[model samples]
Target: MDRISQLPDELLLRILSLLPTSKDVVDTMVLSKRWKFLWMFVPRLLYDDSHQDIDYGRFSRFVDRSLILYKAPALETLHFKLGKICGAGDLHVWIRAADKFSVRELIIEIDSSSRASPAILPRSLYTESSMLVTLKLNNAILLDVSSSVSFPSLKTLRLVSVTYPGNEFVNSLLSNCHALQDLVVDQCPDDNVTILTVKVASLKSLALHTSDDRVEDFAHGFMIDAPNLECFHLRDGTGGFCVIENDMPNIVDAYIDVSYALPRTILSCITSVQHLDLCLLTTEVFFLLQLRVVVLTIAYENISVSVRLLILQDAYPVSSIFPCLVRLKICTCETEWLNLLMRVLKDSHKLQALELGRHHNRGGNVYWSEPSSVPECVSGNLETLEWLDYEGREEEKQVASYFLRFGSCLKKVTIKPESTSYDRDKLVMIKELSFLPRSSPACQISFD
Candidate 1:
């Protein structure tokens, strides 16, 4: 380790760069005299209150002292987490100094409760042609930038809880940041409808999350022409509306959450996706049937029997809904709903693993009626079964019996019953069922 520290200054700085926060790097200064000055040469300076015991004012002073001591012309990265009550003028000065240093990666997070001032970034910081590779701002304001505010070296940009003047403000910012490859916007609101047009052909990743409470009347659309785009995440927290127009052949992962009224049209765009996570009320089951997913996780809340039947009716008829699904996790109550699920699982010939759980509420004497007195053979390829929140009752025994008879290919069974006193009778029942023999497969059952 001593020999490692004796390496060149560039190598030493590289080693220090692995620390997530500046305080962690500072604590290492006490290790030895040789390490005292090493942190000063490190290109990344990250200041987060959550990682240190200093307030905003003290942190600002630390940054000033560090800059004066290092006297470096540029920084590779600069991260600051100023609480909700930061001084506007102090923030402006910090950005101005960062601009002079040509900071490559900048992350500035203001407290969520702080009201943003209209003027935050100095005009010089935006106008200067710097080599900023990544920029992330939260709960801040974007001032007017000159047409010369072109970031030729920028690759990633993220804005969350930020305020913009109008749609034109956002459009101009995106148009100027021409070299951006990744874009993320969360809880950002504009005065008018925003139409985000992406001309950056190198863009590969995009994440958009809107507020569910504030509905914006914007007919939003993306004109993405990037052939190399791979990952996309779109969530409507505010229940806003958006339209996507792109044929991404390289996209491998996608997540879509929207109101029941707007689920189908948005998902119809991504026909070649492989992995998907869906959370919807029962009405959106039609859209769930279209995806060719290998892993499917579905969450339903306060769903009624009529809606549940609709899902079973569609899922059982066409195995193509989850034809490639090998792992399935269903979050529902241990009530009659299991009958509907059993019907669905009987059709999933390719399923290998199953996870069943009851909701946190509705916990006692939960009953699950089998689809038939003679258990229907289910997922003959299933090898593992997990029952979550199992409150060992007669209902649980019935469930175990159904699995014992129908799960011919099962090899492992896990019963995670509620953490309570175990009944001796239920324990004996589980033990006897574990030893049952069949020509299909030997199943192992355990409880926690």
Candidate 2:
């Protein structure tokens, strides 16, 4: 370690930069006099005080001291993971120092579960941090944000569960970030933002989530105009209006998990996406017209039997929809599984792969009764069958046996039981599946 001190300042700072946390870098100063100020020039600083044993005053002092003496030419990354005990003044000073050092990336997370209020940010953060390229703030309060707030160099901004004084904050702050390409905003249940306006033209990726826990059912929503966006994920449980001002021509992938949040509006904007993962609470959505590979999340326990039938009819248009369908995945809550399975299998003429995921303690038990006629896909086209968390129930066994008895083209059947299943139970299931009649001579069974 003594010989390491002989290294030049640049070489020493570079070596210190490899440390995971700022504390590790600071601890190196005790090695020798040559190492005393080396950590101050390290490009990266990660300070986290989640450990319960940490003294608040001591933690603040260490962070303040580190920033005050930080002589890095340009801070590449500065992460502060302090809790509610940290005041705005302390954070303001640290952020100003980061600005002074020309930080490229800044991340600050204050615990939201703490008894104290959210950390209110200082005005300097929005106005002075012109050099910051990436900024992420969680559980912080954004107040007095200027309409002229400029983050010209900033490319990514994530405000998760953060509070904004008004709905205007989104449009006002994002308008100035000319270089921003990635944006994420996960609103808290009580965030005062009523109508978030995301009108950035340069944005390439956006993930926006709004909660529905608020008691009032106001006309809340979003106004989007990002035409160049390539990736989008929207989970709006608030059942609000979402207006897309322009078409997203460059969209490649999207995941939509919404509830009564106007499925038509959601579909119109994501017309050009190459891939989509959709989740809606009701059966009003019917965009799976051209689905080749479909993943259905089934939780139809609470829904009335008539509504469930309507969901199958409207959501998955069987006659023409499954003609071209090949692969299907159903992550279900064990709610009337046989009805949904038989409906799809009956029409999916070219279906080849089937994957069933059974989530425990959800919905209701599925009682399987043999179908009158074997589907064409099951007897001829089906090649692979996968069951995740297979409980080896009698109903499950009957369904498994039915597939084995009829699937002439079955290549492999894989079964993964729940973690709590005993080794003896697994062996029993394997033996039972092995003894079952197989229509295909080369069919293989696996349980592991």
Candidate 3:
């Protein structure tokens, strides 16, 4: 017999609770008679049916038996994923059973191959369960709650593909969750929620992602007023106007990813952020649209209205606007990114590190534009420069040469050439770049 089997039942049950799934915990029952009923007392239960080999009939039978036979006084966590086979009514019964046991953390993932209808969440979830500290629902429906919603101890809430009656229900649900700290809403596809206002005073971290496939004609957006928020992430799918009423003076970091144009209001909200990341679709890369001041025209019959726009139309004088910015990273393959780089270097006087690369997307070429004057950072605070998937094009070489020549306080410049380039070509580019005059005698140029 193994020494582990000799441990007390309490210790054995604690050991089993750390496993990834309750199914794994049950499998240990066959180890010995002492282990047979130990899993029944485990505080955490997790069921996942995403695997292709999962036997639906057997899994259902197992869940039904587990809930009935479970003897734990209180469940620390209860998680289950009901795929296409399980009905919403059955899931409601499961939630009620878990509620009887006083579960503290509950995660239900409803993934149905059928898009015809989404599973409806039980009403008891909002009105009766006060012990819940964490709640996550995916691909589920939340019916309108006319009663006062309650979850006194709840701190984290994540809803993905969850449909509610309308935006008011969502607002009411969040407003009542007084102790919430982390909230995530991802890709909810109901037309009833055209405009959403999230006003959580206690929220500290928030993430919101919308679908990129939204129709252009739809009126959809969000308004936020979280005063004490520290971190925020927004992955916008299209052009939607987002308004932030309260200034987030306590914000430390922010990540913004958009498929199309970002609203003007967003940039102003993150002025105090020390770290910032901007990700966008290749078609929406700023400099590609910056090559010329293009006049976008709309015509009806013989009449045309011409609208002149800048690359950063609503956001100009980037440095003065972001006075607190310290570190900046740009992930783009657009050749015109250098133009934006110059503007940032001129404005962000406190910037310490700069990173440039193709982020999550393939690389192409870097376009070179003559800078009218040397950027402030090139002569002062800039320390490190790193570039990934560098193609060593002529424009890239010129830009590298300019930075190497003018960066008086620069310490390191690291470049990684794209895999398509020949080893000999990389060496030639390295030697040529290495010979350029460096303003900072200690500045080192390394190539990969």
Top-scoring candidate (TM-score): 3
lDDT of each: 0.60, 0.74, 0.74
The digit string of per-residue lDDT tens for model 2 on 171-255 reads: 7888878999999998887778777889899999999987545543325567788999999988775554456778887887777
Model 1 off-target regions past 4 Å?
1-15, 18-36, 49-58, 71-74, 84-89, 96-102, 113-119, 123-126, 146-149, 175-179, 188-201, 212-228, 284-448
> What is candidate 1's CA lDDT for residue 2?
89
Q: Which runs of model 2 end up more than 4 angstroms from their true locations?
A: 2-15, 18-20, 211-220, 239-250, 261-278, 282-330, 334-361, 364-386, 392-413, 420-445
Model 3 quality (TM-score): 0.83
Cα displacement (Å) at residue 408, model 2: 8.7
Lowest lDDT sum, 10 consecutive residues, model 2, at 289-298
Candidate 3, 167: how far from true, in Å?
Answer: 1.9
Q: Check candidate 1 and list the clashing pairs.
A: 211-237, 211-238, 212-237, 212-238
lDDT of 2: 0.74
Worst 10 residues of 3 by lDDT: 297-306
Cα lDDT of model 1 by residue, 1-448, tens digit: 7898789988888888888888787777888888887787788888775333457677778767766666557788888876535666766666766777888888887765443442254455566536788989877766665464577788899988777656666766776777888988775555243444455567788887765545533233333445556777776533223444456666656665443334444444444455444333232333443231111112333222333332233322333234444665554532334544554465445667777765335443445756643323253577888887765566767777777677778888887765564577557656766665533557777776
